[model samples]
Target: MIRLLRLLFWILIGRPLVLIVLGLNVRNLKNLPLQGPAIVVANHNSHLDTFVLMTLFPLSRLHRLRPVAAADYFLKNRVLAWFTLNIVNMIPLDRTKVGKRGEDPLENCGKALAAGEILLVYPEGTRGATDSLAKFKGGVARLKEQFPEMPVVPVYMQGLSRALPKGEIALVPVVVDVFIGEPVAWAGNRQAFTQALQDSVTALAAAAPHPTWK
Candidate 1:
């Protein structure tokens, strides 16, 4: 029942809103992983980032795509927790209390990957200013450390901040550009790998056409 609801929500609302209402200009769509046990890393700018990334894949693969989100924010309320966990298919990570009480912050993430699910992660840890890339956190690198062979796909998005900037509820009609770069291989160390991932995203952002709007 939950799966059906999720499919219906994305098919009827999410896809149309993203693809039609707010146009997407995607390049190198082939770089995205068609299967799971992979990580899709991106620079964070707005809440729409997750929705846009998820829409890139077919609805048939919806169940296999899990966006790693902040547990405090998404699970703050019962209703939202239910919706996000069931409908959005999010894997929540408690950012504030990492490793507390013998809990592994990446436990759920690791489990998801072990189950052959693709993780959509915003390495920035949080949204940043419009049209700017912030320093990435080490969580993504650590996750990759566990599954060293798993491909880490880098993607960059523009115009999403203007469309649905942080702290705003309504979305403006802006054409979002998505650039998918080739997978960034492990650089033999977490620090190096994280830097490489950031570089890949930065390069993609550089390739994107500048937004015409302010």
Candidate 2:
């Protein structure tokens, strides 16, 4: 109910509101897989990355896809907390703690897969300032290991950083490009898996002609 309303609000009101004013050009809608338990991994840059990713699919799939987001940031505010958890159906990830030393949200992802749900995860533990991807964490590798059968799709989002930078609320009009690469095969080895994941995202990012920063 809440999810439906939010989706409608974003589509009819929110996205167009941005598009009318900012002139958002989101392309490559045909690339995303329509069904099954697949891990959609991407390079994280700004808060707008999720919104841009959401625009890649139709409103129907937007209801189906659940973006794996950080627990702290999303849950910080009351309105966003309710929307991300209940509306967006986001899988809450503990970004602060990781590996054996901290509480892992990867296990929850496994459970979601068992339930036959699509997941979106940012292999980069945190958001990056530059276009180049950072070293990917082992969680993605571990998830692949746990579910070797599932495909890991890599997507690259360009111009989102420019749309709404790290510390800014107002979104600037920018032509955002979303490149969806072919599904990456999972190798059994953790190191190898992580490397492959990183490589795919890097390749996708390279596909776009983003302005380089100092």
Best by TM-score: 1
Candidate 2 per-residue C-alpha lDDT over 8-34 given as tens digits, one digit per residue, 9 for 90 to 100: 777786577455654554445555777
TM-scores across all candidates?
Answer: 0.95, 0.87
List, residue by residue over 110-132, the lDDT tens digit for candidate 1. Answer: 99999999999998888888756
The reply for model 2, stretches above 4 Å from the true place, is: 17-29, 100-103, 211-214
Against the true structure, candidate 2 reaches a TM-score of: 0.87
After superposition, which runs of candidate 1 have C-alpha atoms over 4 Å from their true positions? Answer: 99-101, 211-214
Error of 1 at 50 (Å): 0.9
- Give each model's whole-structure lDDT: 0.90, 0.75
Error of 1 at 129 (Å): 0.8
TM-score of 1: 0.95
- For candidate 1, the clash count comes to 0
